[model samples]
Target: MSIYLTAILKSKKDKIQDLKSILDNMVLNTKKEEACEKYELQQSLDDEAVFIFHEIWKSKEGLDAHNQQPYIQEFVEKVPDLLEKPAEIYLAKLV
Candidate 1:
């Protein structure tokens, strides 16, 4: 079955633009993966520093592979300094 993921990221007050640029690169690179079904980046209207990633993959394996990608790893390594808090991630399936 397809796997769905939602990740919420909150950038530090001064790092929002930098975080957005990094995330934009991640989105571009991630969408090229063969197992990726959908990938989207959303910024909150009420909070400029809050961003969300909505993703769909072919299967759990696919998502796992995605997690291991270099771009993803780079994002993980870089986010701590840029974020206000730890990212929140949810894994789910379509109802």
Candidate 2:
């Protein structure tokens, strides 16, 4: 079965631009993955510091491989300095 993921990240008051750059890079690389059906990024109009990712993966194994990519690992390392809090992630079904 396909997997859908929604991830919301909030940047520190001063780190929105930096966070956006990283996320943009992620989009570029993620789009190259064979198993990524969708990997769209969005910013909230009401809260500029909030970033969201709407992603769909072909399988759990594909998503796991994605998490291990070097760029993604770098994001994990750098996020502590850029984010206001841990990311909010959800796995949901289309129903």
lDDT by residue for model 2 over 2-95, one digit each (tens)?
9999999999989999999999999999999988999999999999999999999999889999999999999999999999999999997678
Off by over 4 Å in 2: none
Model 2's alpha-carbon lDDT is 0.96
lDDT of each candidate versus the true structure: 0.95, 0.96
**How do the residues 10-64 of candidate 1 rate in per-residue lDDT, one tens digit apiece?**
9999999999999999999999999999999999999999999999999999898
In terms of lDDT, the poorest run of 10 residues in model 2 is: 86-95
> Model 1, residue 5: what's the lDDT?
92
After superposition on all C-alphas, the RMSD of every candidate to the true structure, in Å, is: 0.7, 0.7
RMSD of 2: 0.7
TM-score of each predicted structure versus truth: 0.96, 0.97
